[model samples]
Target: MDTNAFRHTLTAFRAPRPGAAPSNTVHRSLAQRQRAAVSQPWLIGASLAGLMIAAPALAQGEAALPTISVSGSQYDADDVRPEGVTTATKTYMAPKDIPQTIDTLEVNKYKSYGINDLATMLDGVPGVNTNYDMRGEGVLIRGFSADSGDIYRDGIRESGQVRRSTANVERIEILKGPGSVLYGRGGGGGIINLVSKQARFDAKSSVTLRGGSWDNYGGTIDINKVVNPHVAVRLTADREQAHSFRSGIRNKNEMISPSILVDTRTGLRWAGQYTYDNVWRVPDRGPVYGELPASVSTHQGFAHPDDYVQDRLRVLRSDLSYDFNPAWSLRWLASKREASQDFDHVFGGTYCNTAGRTATGAACNYRGQLRQNYAWQATNNKTTTHTLDLTGRVDVAGMRHELLMGLEHSSEERQPQVYGTVPFGATINPHNPVWPAKPAQRPAATQNNLHEATSRALYVQDLIHLAPQWKLLVGARYDSYDFDTLNRLTNARRAASGDSVSPRAGLVWQPTAQHSIYTSYSKSYSPYGGRGMLGVSGAQDDEPRYSRQMEAGVKSDWLAGALSTQLAVYDLEHYNIRYQPDAVNFPNDWAVRGKERSRGVELSAAGRLAAAWYVRGGAGVMSAKVVEDRSAPANVGKYLINTALRNGNIFVRYAPQGHWYAELGVTHTSARWINAANTQRLPGYTRWDALVGWRTAPWTVTLALSNLLDKEYWRSTSMPGAPRSVLLSANYQF
Candidate 1:
């Protein structure tokens, strides 16, 4: 049936009062009985008799309860039915029905926490860690790092290679453990999918302005409008800037995103989105070991040498879903993403010479032993993807079940250009560090081309119900990937391809209405790394390494699902792998023979504790030791990653029914080594942030203080400690 016709029928069917007697009913209308027979051919015997008996009530403005709500498929946390899981899984398996951990973060959570970025918000999730580099942001789950190919948006594959902002997200789902059975790539560690906000049936708009520390200021405007009953569009734009804090570094950012959704009268639902981001910054060059002047104290502030960087990114995606029937549906998605970055670094800007050769006190010279150097770098790439999925429900033996089948394909084209420049300078005396400058010399630029030979996958899963309280899930997937690269300078091209079959099995048992237990095993595969991370040789798919995981866990929900918790134990194996030496030491070199492994356990807990008070937190402790490192010392035994040992977080929230709210959060990170040597430790530390907010209709004011204690901590694997800073912001929604 068509959408409008279906809506009208449903509306009429649910409009009448219960037990109302029929008014226009005849003993038996031939047309009505014929239509009912055609619509519900499976109804028979007693069920057919019952429907016939109730036909008068239906025709008389007396109907049964309506299953559809104004909120669509979304439901309030407190209203979820017991033992009924979300359709995110074909069978609506309760959390317990899925052995692995799958955490869902709703839009309401982001509103309450005021979280606008994935890194900051996900920090509260258990087993999730983030590494903030000068270049961008990266995350690690369960001690394993995030891969570029593992990201998704609304069930569609996303490069997620851009590290700009997460303001456009409606919610985020972090599925723990390998998910190759469902999602083909980068499932070794797990995957985090960002679901973008959509234009709802109702129209809503908001605009916010904020200002904070370090000269940081920004504003955002988001609007959603329903042009007609079946069409809607949303637009968002924001800009932010910050300057000079611990060092004389400056940063600036701007973003614009727009999306349109079309709900047609036909059974088709579609949405298209486009995002543009640009960021520019001059990062601190940091200090060199033993380069200080005698009169200049370490505590004294100093400006960094020339360091500038600019990044631009663009993303476009279209998603579609068609409802063939109430119990069956299909979805198709397509997307394109691209990014470009430019960087320049200059050193020896009036360098000071004090004990330059030795770590000792000596006469300080402002000019001796000085030289100027410059370097330029750039990277550009683009990717396109397509996916088709079908979902349906079935019944066997007296129990109901769900099944999902799908196919995916993606192609990427990348061209990375490398360039460098050097300028001549007049000779200067040893007493003067500044030299006469000359025009900069332009160096040769080389462009390299890389192409992904389209990765494809087909998979199907079945959720079997043996009883009302028990379920079994069985699934398998066939994945294929091909890749090729051309060296622009050398004109060298190479190609490779491979495929794999993965299987998954699990069982869930619900001993009580609010609790469930399950165990499962799944497999995952990826071509070592995607085209971007892997060099020409590593891009070969001939022997794509694979990873396997075995997990079993229990989940509990109480207080009508307002409060939830999960406990899981897992063992992960990464095989047919290759390990490269430290990037800092080896730089661009590749490792021909790579083999390594990591195995460990993870734990986490989250959700609300009470109405006015909410608590969401998690802890991850693991023993992730590298089994082998061909370049490491023989007696080293294992390369134990200290950073993978432990990570924890906790948050307390208080919001009354009035117009005020407050929240405080504490985060802890364990010390990790910079490399396998284990001599240098990252120095574990704890930090806290707090906020107090007020809201009255369209006006919302907030006082936020991050790093309240101004603690000195470091997150850079290269740098030991990072100085603390603060930001205070206020925003208004209209």
Candidate 2:
């Protein structure tokens, strides 16, 4: 195939209109930009060095082009439309065909903007909010909290406490609404699925180094090799060490991932992957009571300089596929994941009351507004998960159907240990804190409790093409969860068991290949054994709580598939929420008589605007409220905590056929309540980011600035957004 013809086909859908500038002028301008780029001495030198390093490979006939295509359609290595998503139905389908709202962050988008972590990468997704927690980064999808257990890697559950690295990520898929039909025992908020880089038969290699403000520095290496026609291998690794903007806080992390694929001559394929990660950091809790005082410094943290938190993770995965015929295929996947975390730090507790001073209030100052630090609080947790899936596709009654059936089992054990606290002679004022010297002979922590949980699930889903312009999706899942808790201090043991079934249905109508309107309804459940925020246990007789959602959306492709846009409206309700009836007298007495609801409209657009312009952005308007609260009448009809009423983000980039490009972006979030009673609030804020880069074939350099206006704002309750910072990055491909 002629290469120019192939390029034209990709752009033909968005061809310039009549009466516009001649296409020849555009070609000439591109040529002029290339010539101008060549005049830059640094760019020329970098290009020459890259060519010299690749000369030997070219001489040996090992140098290959950046992308390869066969027939008239391009393959994975070259597709750039960003119209496909797999997490929604566990099958590759256009977003327009799916009946639910799903958002994706492609590797190119994040790489261009120099986003390095999962939290930052999710900035522009509609209805998604990010925050910080003592354990790890926290997220709220729709309106409910999604913890580490709610995150997945390659469709397998992974711990959320570990910091996520983007070095080995191919893309990030955000599945909105209820997902229990695929994943088991998760909140209704939704899930974040991280797709890892796969081994390519066409080999490629690259290395990148980055440095930024706060003494941040890191390096990543990605290498892929095709050993033979049947075997391919790929490896990715990265190391980062940095000091935080907060005083006495530092971070260090390392990750390595390797994958292999085997294709037999008999229409069978197999792949295997493994990843190891180790991370260490000093934990920081933002200002007291989620507020910054005039006398307090944003850069100061109450945690000791030596306090630290660490996480270690290991994962193994395998996949196999066989084609039985032109219309039939079978695929199976299995994975095992293990994770552990250890933390020791001082965190802000209750405000000291000097007037009511007693032995417990000895640390209080005369002001009675000081924050007493909880010292030597330590915890260790470990979890293991295993999963298996089998999927197939066939044609029945002149209709094509894709089916996925899976099984999952997970076991988790957590042991929390806290040492005796050492009282400080001087009270640490919230507005002004005085550093305290390290104490000698720190006490050893004894096991406080052992909590263990085991879960098993079976699920199946089918996508059926009912007609040329209509599609139907149906699915269900059954889960069995069991938990056991043993209190060492009280010598008490308790166990609980529960089961639940979740269901989903959707219908889609396509008036044209570029436009689709769809509606869907789904249900999700969370057993007591699942991550509980209220310290409730599964030992009770109460069954698992459930959530239901109804959503309708329209998806359209514009500019000949160069751009994709989506508009969706949804109503979600969560029931059987646990609440304390009387916190002052019966703090531990809880009842499941609470209900929450979220109604929202979301709009999103992504992909290319023109040959030289690229854009990705979204906006959301949501109203989350406590619908019913029999246990806490004061919170009835109140807005949900941390659920913003409006949020949006947009990024625009201009990159012609030259060695230089520039980008500008903005993110905005509306004010939100910080408590169930809606008494405290977090003000709204907007942040800006900019990027400039120059590239020549295998070498590229970039400068990225975050918080361009240096806005001082809170991202969550007390978590302040990072101040203005700059990052410089360089990449070389071989």
- Please list the Cα RMSD from the true structure of every candidate, rounded to 1 decimal place: 11.8, 10.2
Q: Distance from true position, residue 18, model 1, in Å?
A: 28
Q: Going through the candidates in order, what is the number of backbone clashes in each?
A: 2, 1
Worst 10 residues of 1 by lDDT: 58-67
**Local distance difference test scores for all models:** 0.54, 0.65
Q: Estimate candidate 2's RMSD in Å.
A: 10.2
Question: Which segments of model 2 are wrong by more than 4 Å?
Answer: 1-83, 111-114, 289-292, 349-364, 375-388, 418-425, 429-433, 441-447, 533-542, 579-590
TM-score of 2: 0.84
lDDT of 1 at 49: 30
What are the models' TM-scores? Answer: 0.77, 0.84
Can you write out model 1's per-residue Cα lDDT over 377-463, one digit (the tens) per residue? Answer: 666656666666676667777876667787766666656555543422332332323435333554666445555456777888887
User: Model 1 segments beyond 4 Å from truth?
Assistant: 1-96, 104-121, 284-306, 346-375, 419-442, 529-541, 579-601, 631-642, 718-728
TM-score of 1: 0.77
Q: For model 1, what is the C-alpha lDDT against the true structure?
A: 0.54
